[model samples]
Target: MATVCISGALVDKLRACAEAGFDGVEVFEPDLVSAPESPEEIRALAARLGLTLDLYQPMRDVEGVDDAEFARVLRRAEAKFRLMRRLGVDVVLCCSNVATATIDDDEVSARQLRALGDLAAEHGIRIAFEALAWGRYIDDYRRAWRVVELAAHPAVGVCLDSFHILSRGHDPAGIREIPGERIFFVQLADAPRMELDVLSWSRHHRLFPGEGSFDLVGFVGHVLHAGYAGPLSLEVFNDTFRQTDPARTAAQARRSLRHLEDAVARADPSLTGLEMLPDSAAPSGFDFVEIIAEDTSTIEHLLARAGFTSRGRHRTKPVTLWSAGRARVVLNEQHARGRTPYLAAIGFEVDDASAMSRRVAALRTPRAYRRTYDAEEELEAAVAPGGTEVFWAQAADEGEPAWVSEFEHGGPRIASPVTGIDHVSLTEPWQVIDESALFYTATFGLRTVSATDVPGPQGLVQSRVLAGPDEVVRLPLNVAPPILAERGGPAALSAHVAFSCADVRALARAAHLRGLDILPIPANYYEDLAARVDLDDDVLAELRELNLVYDRTDAGEYLHVYTATIGNVFFEFVERRGDYAGFGAGNAPVRLNAQSASSAARESGGFGRVRA
Candidate 1:
């Protein structure tokens, strides 16, 4: 097991951090740093709260300059060390000097590092030498570690950062070999892989752990195996999390932890899953279920032919349904908004939606309000995309109970009607076609469902699907061609269709060899993409060349897949990159062809493959 840290700001933001399974806090420095209380008082608060001080960060620019600057830096280190001593804070995070360094020569820089280490040793503190992304002397850990080893002071250690580690596209094996005792701390943060400068991103937009595109679990495993038993703390400097409520921020923290823990369990059996956290991996959780049609008449005729009966109006959007006991189908119109659901969001049953809503609101995270049918009349349960809904009549409305009662009654099968869709992967691009795919796979545990080549005006793109949480959701991994160059792109693929794959690249290769009109994504996307992805240049190039999309999750698994269309069946071809298991939600279509011949055939009562 690895040590976990609860950031000090998260204490007030998510009072539940410790209760949620965190072992320590980074102290965030500023919490105690600028507080009115004495340093010893903060230590008392930590002891009373059962929280350990994971780290005190950012002794900026300590190395550099002549005798005069050196003296001032030493005095500063001394003051910080005294604060550490008073609070029993054992670890000090000393990032390599980034800005305003007076030294330029290599020899002088080395001398400065040795001096810092010596000062830490005198103050009885262990210094975690981390190279800021823009450090003047030490930038890469491998390069900086040379000075750390040279300092020869046992107090100097390393702080392995997923961002810094991945930003440079370096392998993690070095971390795996470092003595745990010598590795003073591990910093955890994830971000959507971007092409932004390191400093701007770090101070402005780092994401919470498991929320971005980094391979979190594998990163963690590498650290754990390194024998470094330091606290794993989140150092996200996200604008979004800060804008949201503090309580919900805490819940986000908890969920982020659970998502990562569960991802770890799925990716590697050795890692433990969180017990207290609610997960999308919960048994029977439905990702999504689909009933497709080119037009409304087609759907009505199809369901009518199947002898299915229609349920009443949907509480939200334009979703109609046909049902048989324990077996139900939902009909979504083609005209629905956005890429896919201009029609409906999602609905679920809970014993107490209001209570759950209150609990969620108590956390103060953003939430959507919804109304539902109650025991006597209309009742309201605040609803959004995920759980947090209560419907007393959901059992009867859906033709069965929402949850299978294991209370002496839970048995053989509690019908959810049709098993739910794993997840719906809707692939659209803000120019970056892969961003959507990365978001779902990395933040959630969705795996690559499929990847298939499609003809486009611009060329071919082999989009893939990823599925995870092992639920009933269908992610329709879709893809469109690049805006420039090539022939017209292929059209008439469905708005979305979830995919699953045993092998993602092979699937892409299969589609490519199959002559299934493939689209070409730029080769440079891989090189640029490599900055965020942990894979080697070759692997990144191959995935991009195949037009396949992939994202790393907190578990260090690469969820990838290919897109496919089997006649009017419209299915996704999936491949799991590494251990990833998410449906590509980023791949969706602007238009779908339900078989051109079939639409005409249906009008004439000719033979047409019927869909229900």
Candidate 2:
């Protein structure tokens, strides 16, 4: 829900929200209307505190009333609409009448709602008819939708509440059928199911999102599935939450958001690949690109085969290539770059060479080596190798080889696509996921963004990674190196995959259309998934077809996936779109099956598809 409003009574609620990293907050009417607080004062405070006034809510009883009162409420709605336009807010909360004389007359309510919605739309705002669980006429979303359908005003929409929806234990099968445009508001609140009357629970004693028993996540997923992309407010009737320190409350609110985020990700079964994306927090591209190549000559041969020409010669490290587009590749000749390379690093663009060096050093780990510029160039190098470790930084400002005389004198240049090392894969020997997580956290200040662990015949190794700023560069660290070879030789041919994707869905579609044959585990994956992440079939299937997987652990969020290609040297097409912090873990089993089948084909010299 985009327009989630917190009642103004929770004005202190802003404190709770800020602590929790909320992007905006909605202003409930009671806190503003009931109080002596002026709209000017409320607006000013929100601006001063960096909160968007998501909405002015609770314009109740506009529908199912006689002409006189209906006209009066219409005027009141106009005034609020004025305030909203001035405040740059676009939504209004209109709850169904509870205390008024309106009986369950859908026809009458529908007529009145249409008239009022037209009035509100003039002021550039929409009305959200909330089906109060205890309302005299409208209570359930299905009922509200029927009324809205007849009302049929573009600005007239529904407010889906987690409390109202889940409190009754309604199934989502019917709700998912609603179109996206009709969903104007979403309210999520949690509470222990008290023995008291439903009305009393709605009025007081509502718990925060994660603190309650109701499946708010699932409910939100349902609403999302219905195509309602609007404001989502946390409207809680909990007295305890209000009484606590506002910041703590807000932090809890943020935690609730993260909690719900993970819940939605895990709850959606359509997932396939788990990839941590790059972030803008760090100025560079990638900390390092892992290249696991055994025979040093093979490392050399592989580079030659890939059209990667050396930048004169390798220094500090062996068989490294300094390329165009501000990129560099380190061939760890220890193991012929596994069908999946180890430590394929991306070079980061840096403005302050010294400051970046200090920042990298601050992240403690196997101390990185600082490479001094040789006789040819001025840029120095530093290498940090743990998953989150800041393995290397090539100063684009003063240290690149292009600035040196050789390239300048020869009028030379590198190839197109201007190489920028996008990602790297690291392996941890410890079988424990937490231990691997600790490696990234300690070395690179990397936190576990997302993860997953599935029960397979071969078991699973939970994965984690430090998603650097905006999650633009992902350095993934694996827990329990998949047992590729028993003798600690390179982790196996099915070892790992490094991918690049212009569009992840296109990659999946490419595979599928080419008869790569994706697996179908369950049809229900979509039933509840869209409700969680708000992704469409194209994106979801692509993620699934890619075999991305994810999971939730007490330690943190995790998700990932391996591809369908052969054991070695395949790619994972990744595009860091948003806060998806993990790879697609939901697609693991599908990936395993396809991979095993592909491997079999190579041995038998014949490839076949999974029969429907």
- Displacement of residue 307 (Cα, Å) in model 1 is 9.0
Report the C-alpha displacement of residue 442, candidate 1, in angstroms: 9.3
For all candidates, the clash counts are 91, 90
lDDT for predicted candidate 1 compared with the true structure: 0.52
Sliding window of 10 residues with minimal summed lDDT for model 2: 272-281
* Candidate 1 lDDT by residue in tens digits, 1-612: 011222334335224455544566666566665567777776776667677776777677776577888788889888988888887877788877777676765466667767777777777778888867777767777766666766666777778887788766677677766777877787777776678888777766666665566888788877877776556677777655555445444556654655565556667666443232222321233322345343444444433332335554354545565543333445656454333221133333333444434434333234444433353234333332222222222224344554222112211332121222324434343222333343344333355546666553334545655544443443444554544213222243334333343454554564454344333333454565577767877876677666655666665444443233222333333444454444332332211222333334445876322111
Q: Which residue runs does candidate 1 get wrong by more than 4 Å?
A: 1-16, 33-36, 102-111, 262-308, 311-321, 324-445, 448-472, 476-612
User: Local error of candidate 1 at 467, Å?
Assistant: 3.6
- TM-score computed on alpha carbons, candidate 1: 0.55
Query: Distance (Å) between predicted and true CA of 134, model 1?
Result: 1.7
Tens digits of lDDT, candidate 2, 233-262: 677765544454455445445445544554
